[model samples]
Target: MMKVMAFVGSPRKGGNTSKIVNSICTGLKENGHAVEVYYLSELDNVGCKACDSCQANKVEYCAINDKMTTLLPKIADADCIIVGTPVYMLQLSGITKNFLDRLFTFYRRSNHTARYLPGKKYMTVTCNGAPAEAFGNVTEYLNQLFNGSFKMKNVGNIITGNLTNKDDILKQQGVLEQAEELGRKLS
Candidate 1:
């Protein structure tokens, strides 16, 4: 079975972002893929320190001794990564940004290559109160990170707008179905 790592960047439990991620996880599990979900807001993860310790030492993992350090191995071992977040101030949530920053550990200074998790499949789920078209830049940022920097394949993405409440996404049946289909395809 493929290993899938899912990160929920919303602090609210059972929020729209969480529900969407859980739906994706359900699809992955149904397809016989192992899924692990991490709530970023609950984790004590910190941003990249820019210490360059990982690069200098040529280590495969980050040097920071935070919760992300423990998750690094899991990330490396996974076949796919699913990131779900609620838009904040026209960008990703602070915790999600920090989590992405921690991924810098995967970059190697010797050859400017991603040391681990390269070629893995990745998908993003972004929920915003504004129109989806209005936040195309946010999606582009995610694309740059997953496709460009990490050198991962873009499996798919779910960008649902006008979701201000936890249950609002439930009304968007098509989006939910799309998320499940995306997960199944990833597996």
Candidate 2:
């Protein structure tokens, strides 16, 4: 079974991002794949230190000794990754941006190449308060990061909008089902 690491970028534990990620995990679990879920806010990471220690291979992954120290290794070992976030100001949430910034450790600054991230499978989920098509750029940005920059394979993406409430995703049962189905297809 493939190992999948799912990250919820929303601080709200029960928000749309978390719910969709949970649903995807449920499907992955049903398919006998190992799924580990992590909430960004609860991780308490101090964000990236920009020390380039990880780039220098000084400490393995960014010098910060927070939860990311534990998670970066997991990210490297996992076969697939799923990132879910709610759009803020037509961009990724601050916590999500910080988390992505920390991933700079994977890069080789000399040649702008990443060793561990290439060939990894990745999926994205984006929720916005605007219309579904309004924030297409957010998903494209994520794609550019994971697919263009990292050279990871694009497994899928769930870009949706008009979810203003915390539990707004619950009402979109169809989207939740699609998320689960996406998970099942991975395995």
Candidate 3:
């Protein structure tokens, strides 16, 4: 079974984004894959400071000692990663952006290494209050961030749109099913 690190990037705990990620994890677990859901809202995460300490001394890890620092090791060991976020102002949420920023350390140190997180697979889940098509920009942003910046293989992206209320996503049977289906396929 694959070990998947699932990150819920929405600040609203158990919000629409979280539900979508949870659905994916549920399917992964059913398929016998180990899933760890990291809730950013519950952790005290400071945005990346661009200190480059991780590049200078690999042992120091990320310069900031916030919750994300603790996750570095787990992320390094995971076979796959899943990131879910709600689109804010036509972009990824602030927390998600910060998390992505922190990954720059890997980019800095592994600039010449083709195997940097080479075997790992990843997928993105994005939700928006506007039409689903509006999420294309953010979806492409994440895809390029992970696929190009990190050099990780992208499994796929799930975008749920037109969800203004908390329950809007859960009420969308197709999106939830898509999330689960995506997880199953990943497994």
Candidate 4:
């Protein structure tokens, strides 16, 4: 079974992003894949220190003595990863941005290459108050980071917009179903 790790980057527990992520996880679970979900806003993590400590140490892991010290290892080992975020101020929320910044640990500055992330599969979920097309840039940025820089393959992105409230996602049954199908088809 695939080991899937999902992160809800929205602080709202039952928000649009969380609902979409849960739908995806539900599909993966039905397929007998092992799924673990983490709420980024609730997790104890600090932004990257930029000390190059991860690249400096022989082990090549972040030196931060927080939750990520352990979580980063799990990320490296995960077969698939799902990241869901709610757009804020035309960009990723602070919580989501900070968590992604922590992923710098996977970069090996030595040879300008990345380690432990190539070939892995990743999916992104984004929710916004504007129309769906408004935040393609946010999803594009994430694609470039996970697909281009990390050499990870993107399964697909679930981009939902025109969501005024959390439960508005429930009205978008089509989007949720698409997310579920993605997880079910995930290898």
**Predicted structure with the largest lDDT when compared to the true one:** 4
lDDT (10s digit) by residue, model 1, range 64-151 = 7778889988998889999998999989999999999888778776787886767999989898999777777777899998888789
Candidate 2 lDDT over 67-104, as tens digits, reads 88888888998899999999998799999988899889
Each candidate's TM vs. the true structure? 0.95, 0.96, 0.93, 0.96
At residue 179, give the lDDT of candidate 2.
Answer: 92
37-85 per-residue lDDT for model 4 (tens digits): 9999887676887888777774557777888677899999999999999
The weakest ten consecutive residues by lDDT in model 3 span 107-116
How much lDDT does candidate 3 score? Answer: 0.83
- Stretches of candidate 3 exceeding 4 Å from the true structure: 58-60, 109-115
lDDT of 2: 0.89
Q: Which residues of candidate 1, in runs, are more than 4 Å off?
A: 58-60
Question: Which candidate do you rate higher for lDDT, 1 or 2?
Answer: 2
Best-to-worst order by lDDT is 4, 2, 1, 3
Candidate 4: Cα lDDT at 41:
84
Pairs with steric clashes in candidate 4: none
The better-scoring model by lDDT among 1 and 3 is 1
